[model samples]
Target: MRTSPPEPLAAALVEGRTSSLKEPLLRDGRLLWLEQRPQEQGRTTLMLRPAGGDTAVELTPSPHNLRSRVHEYGGGVYAVGGNDLVFVDDSDRCLWHLNLPGAPRRLTTPGPRAFADGLIDGPRRRWLGVMEAEGRDQLVAVPLAGGEPQRLHQPADFCGYAALSPDGRQLAWVEWQQPFMPWQRSQLWLAAVKQDGALEGARPVAGARPVAVAGSGPNATDAETDTYTDTSAISVFQPLWISPTELVVASDASGWWNLQRLDTASGAWQPLLPLEAEFAMPQWVYGMRTTAWDGQQLIAAAAREGAWQLGRVHLTPDRVGTPAAWEPLEQPFDDLAGLSAEAGTLVALASNPTSLEGLLELDLTTGSWRHSPAAPCPLQPEAISQPEPLWFAGHGGVRTHAWFYPPAGGAHAEAPLLVKGHSGPTAMARRGLSLGIQFWTSRGWSVVDVNYGGSTGFGRAYRERLDGQWGVVDVADCAAAAQALVAAGKASAARIAIEGGSAGGFTALAALCFTDVFRAGASRYGVTDPSALASESHRFEARYLDGLIGPWPEARATYEARSPLAHADQIRCPVVFFQGLDDQVVPPEQTERMAAALEANGIPVEVHRFAGEGHGFRSGSVRIQVLEATEAFFRRHFQR
Candidate 1:
């Protein structure tokens, strides 16, 4: 029997006229969100859908770019209260105020400062948020009527997720110091709000506490041990004030990020609806919400077994410590975020295997929902390849997860495999519809999105699999995923290739150097030198290597051993690199050096550098070019 060749999907169908939706907010029956327009040079604009209206309208016009750069990968850019909207303008990194039916006004003076994760304090007539300036982060208050910003608190090196009590008497927020990412360790803080809007008696109420230790340093004698303390390892996320004295937060002390109620008076942490599922995600950006209170029940999003679902917990305040009733809502989406609930309404950014990300609105009373898609998907349902969850034996013979996407039409005999390592090294490869994956599958390619050991959506123990073993663990898992497909007769062993961006790029390069499964690879702004990343990376990840690869100078040998550039000669197949010249995270120099090393070893290597781009490619033209070039390179090298 003979089969016809599959049709190739055009690159324009994947990149053109596509918008990314984020940060959905529901206020007074109104829906607001941020839409990143790729056709508009990746400018994110504010969008609003009026109450009882079907059509949504754009609020911030061109050149506004409603965004924040507080931690570079900014989230929590805009906040709304009644008729007032406060946002951090990307152009000037200043806070801007917008009153309904009026022009936007600049509230903060222009400087190096940037604000995010803000909320309007109606009672005080101020906007309170985390401000980043001169590499220092502090909780600040800026007058809504326009004035100099006031510093409210600087409890740690970073702070965000500020929530003012309903009575406006107390405030709660999450903060963390260096050497650890927010997901690894963070503190939940509580403070009294003074009449003058200053914080009084602020202290940590939840999260890991660092206790002093003697002789904790590597190579330290007894004399130097007492000065060192182990870094905190518990993470607390999104403190929401249900009342003036009671609040709920997600803490990972139970090995999973679960809901916990913190009583302000006694500083007691009470477990709420204890479950094995995760109720929080990594705080890579600000303004992330997974749980919300809608005046009656607690609406939450939980990740279980690599997929996300919406659930509600009925709280019984009188019966303390009584397990709440957990009801999982039947929804179409598997990936959810930006959850906001108020006045019997719930809004979130959601997507499933057949849908692109969109603003999802649910009526708590009726249990009905509506979706506003970010963009019209170009491909038909039949052309989209759905992800089939696969559990394979990975490094150390432990079970690892991946999503397998066969050819669009159906499974193809001996199809070429494209293994993808998702960025973050801490991020998950969700079961969502991705046009990019469809682009290849439509051309008869099999794709596997590997959720390697360190990827989230799993428990904390699974996420720590890459601790001090970033390159080794990620590389092994990706190779094992591809090999699993080969063993199952789903992919051709000789034609498998791998690709990734940022941290995932590191995984791809490391796989190429250390494993024999992948014949070619593509890396976008990938890290080739762990030592360089440790010393020259930004402040947010300055101490990231302390956990991923061990403390900097102390583990210099391990860094050199794991670097792909140092082992580029071992890569026998062709490789292509895409890098943004202005990328601050993984600089272009790293790509240049790796390409040079591969070229010297007589390996076919191509380096494509884009200007006016940052860590990620935002321009549609660049995105199209990257896809075309990568496809061409893979086709030319894949063994038939």
Candidate 2:
């Protein structure tokens, strides 16, 4: 427990979420959480704690429009939701109701695009599922003694996770319809209630097929109608019903993304974890994929050999059975930031990159499932650092999936190297635990996290290989995976450096303005113009850069030729820039007009900004002072 390294504050390195132990209503101990605070104009809130024994009660109040999220929903009840205003809480709309342990009751009434996804507690009724604000998704129910919510199915473009069928009668959901997004395929409806539980007939189990839905909506069709078959892949995103007939999904139609088993009868889907390459790991429900089903046992959580453990699969679809043998149960922690299963116990959220890390809870009634530590930051499991996984051959040979780390060198040794570029170019840089990759691998750097190439649990045409190649194949596969890790010496091609923070800072300013493979690069709020992120971002990525770099004045010459602030004099290295002047979405005038075109071409430039931060960068001493000012700006510009 030697602690002598802690005094650099605000370059905003990392802290997207925090607040672990909650939902342990273990029949009467009561727990509840969802903290995440930092504030100081560095912005980052989301309160509500309520555990009350050793003490814990924030219950929403950091201020400036409290924003939080959690959904235990058992006896203590939960649905947190945020933003009474911190910057307009779209997804945190509200759902509180702590009840027994006490204080919390907001429950629906958010309307300006209200959102919620993740809450399923049933015995006699309790489901919140929601997603409205026009993305259209529903499931209300509520009545464990609350009343008046009812409003069940909406689905026409998207609907979320609505699972309840263990004698609760029948209601499994996971609909998806759009240009398709829910890991590219989703459809697994199965309603049928009517004995006063409401909800009837619905159907669609293995995501039938058809495709074509062109027409404008709501009586205001000025004109537009071409394609029109309208049906879909019926994909099915997470769905986990464990018995009202049988369930356990996470599809991808066998090209990969395995773990099937489904069969509420005849709709068949069998595969009990046999896609071969072993799967699961690539944002499901934005992140957090549960497998649950306790009344005997069925717990799950995939992401094989590369990590994300806690396996268990005995789910008998009835008869010829013999597949339940997946058990890994919390020993892989380098990414699986969340997990679920109740009563018999199994709460996971293991980490990796480090920061005292947390969110564990495994209890498996004591025969197995142990782990339950690290949360609310205390530090000491060896100062954290776990994300391993790595794989290669991206871009065209495909494959992908990363999280490497090697030079967090303390005495300062094998340093020099920093590749990272993960900002959901459809996200994926799993293998969790991250303190912004240990503030540059604990000073000495040596990191690589490029999950570039339309990521997401590799399937569906390798997640549509960045549909229409965004910024030329995610900036040439993040400079050919850092030139295959500097031709396999595993780093240091002249002190590498590629940093990223949003689309991996648009793949580190398009790999230093069109590939030279790093010599210096950093861009916090990235995206230096892709037609202004398809005309200003966020509405779940406003048309997401017209499907990643296209459209908009007809691609406006590929967004003024792959914006490095419009070719900042073809960047010759030495660059650093972070933004948040209340970033409305890549706007700090695109990093002050690309640091004045790389300081008018003399190169070497630095620009930081963080006033009341927006877009991303939420306090934690300003993300450990943006990871020690990005390792002292790469030791005064690569003299590392």
The number of the candidate with the highest lDDT is 1
Where does model 1 exceed 4 Å of error? 1-6, 211-232
What's the C-alpha lDDT at position 470 in model 2? 77
The sequence of per-residue lDDT tens digits that candidate 2 reaches over residues 201-287 is 655556644533222222212142332233545255566776687777777676667777767766665677664433554432333
For model 1, the run of ten residues with the poorest summed lDDT: 212-221
Please provide TM-scores, in order, for all candidate models, with all chains considered together: 0.95, 0.33
Mind giving the per-residue lDDT tens digits that candidate 1 earns over 1-640?
Answer: 3245456789887886788888888888888888888888788999888988978888899789888887888889998888899988888989999997488999988987788999999878889988888887778888999988777775447789999998888989887877889999888877788887877766666664563222211132334322223334689889987777889999888899988887887776678868989999999998788998877678999999899999988777653668677898887998999898888999999999999988888888888998877788877786678999999999999999999998755665578999999999899999878889988998889999999999998889999999999999999999999998899888888789999999999999999999999989999999999999999998889999899999999999999999999999889999999999989888889999999999999999999999988999888888989999999989888743
lDDT (CA) for every model shown?
0.86, 0.58
